[model samples]
Target: MKRSWWKIACVVLLVYTVVGGLLLPVPALRQLQETIRNLYFHVCMWMAMMTVFTVSVVNSIKYLRQLDLRRDIQASEYATTGVVLGLLGYATGIIWASYTWADPNNPAYASFGSIVREPKLIGTAMALLIYFAYFVLRSSITDMDKKARVSAVYNIFAYAMLFPSIWIIPRLVPSLHPGQEGNPALNVNDVDARMRLVFYPAIIGWTLLAVWITSLNVRLAFIKEKNWLNAH
Candidate 1:
């Protein structure tokens, strides 16, 4: 029996992520406990969101360079996938924060409001808003050609803002979110070897999943357009 490469790869990654997470040594496990397990989902979601957004911006650039409708469709699909993943990632992070910061009964916790006000959280919200505006801008235009062109240009601007809004500004401000203001979580040295084993593969798995979804979205969009064109 021949196994599908993608299926095989996904199974291997799932096993590795789960087993590596379970096998962490006592001291390391104590430092993170069960909360550390959230790393697999939380980190991977963000990584996948970033990958999708990157592709969206790249296709936007290509559309601008060539003024091609196909590229525009690709960019739209990618952006839609990115937004969905970004929202999911934010939701997961909120859950993680609620567990670590909002539950007073937990000794290691802080306050929910404090986490909400964190710079990273604010910046991430702003980034998502910017992308959301891209969809709005696209929808407002009736001319297909003009819509694609304008969206392509808007995508370029939105992509430019993404880095500073999501990455740089967050790090510059003092915050509880990891990897900010010299937070040790940014350091590879800070993550135990066992965590690394799951963390890296989780990134790859989630990114691939995001790509697969985006491709399906693009295909669907193409089919929809074809149907519309035939009807008209």
Candidate 2:
């Protein structure tokens, strides 16, 4: 029961996030309006991505110190999960932008062009692409030890790029995206206290769900690695 407590929490919090995000009152703002409910899903996804990536980098550092193949597998799986969550977050952000940023009077192409040029969007895309290259680097290396060593080093670099690309550079540039001046959802003025109730918990729920998925993947990878070793 103790071991499964977080799994139960993940299910419960996600249900609450969905129900409350839909039904709970949000401060009506120009442009965003009801689309503000996306905060629960879109923002939380990015948060979860950051969490898993942090875990991945930590495991990567452990792999470097201990030279454990198991740690390498764990890092890779966590990174994989982070990439998936990052894509989901990016998709949701784009969808939310189409509704909030697009001018009804303007042509669709014009709206798309503006969104495409957004610094935040571009920065995030760069960050994801960098991680994609990490996987490509891993797959290209035929030697197990060499792959693990090189990929672990590259993973650290990928994580280092995340802060500048997604957080720092985006804020430095002129952007229509909110939270440029400070933490987006954490701002009391931007996100109402009522909304914070669901928003914070949603971050926890999504991150816990990500960790759960990564844990399963790591176990499966270990099994495969074990079987291959035994067969040889």
lDDT against the true structure, per candidate, is 0.76, 0.86
Q: At residue 125, give the lDDT of candidate 1.
A: 76
Scored by lDDT, model 2 comes in at: 0.86
lDDT (tens digit, per residue) of candidate 1 on 38-150: 77887677677777888888998998888777788999898888888878889888777866667667544346556778886776677688788998999999998899999
The Cα RMSD in angstroms, rounded to one decimal, for candidate 1 relative to the true structure is 3.7
Candidate 2 has which clashing residue pairs, if any? none
> Which portions of model 2 miss their true places by more than 4 Å?
165-167, 228-232
Tens digits of per-residue lDDT for model 2 on 132-204? 8988999999999899999999989778866766666765677788887755676678778999999999999
Candidate 1 ranges beyond 4 A from true positions: 1-8, 18-31, 103-110, 181-186, 227-232
Query: Which whole-number lDDT from 0 to 100 does residue 103 have in model 2?
Result: 87
User: Highest TM-score among the candidates is held by which one?
Assistant: 2
Residue range with the least summed lDDT across 10 consecutive positions in model 1? 24-33
TM-score of each: 0.84, 0.92
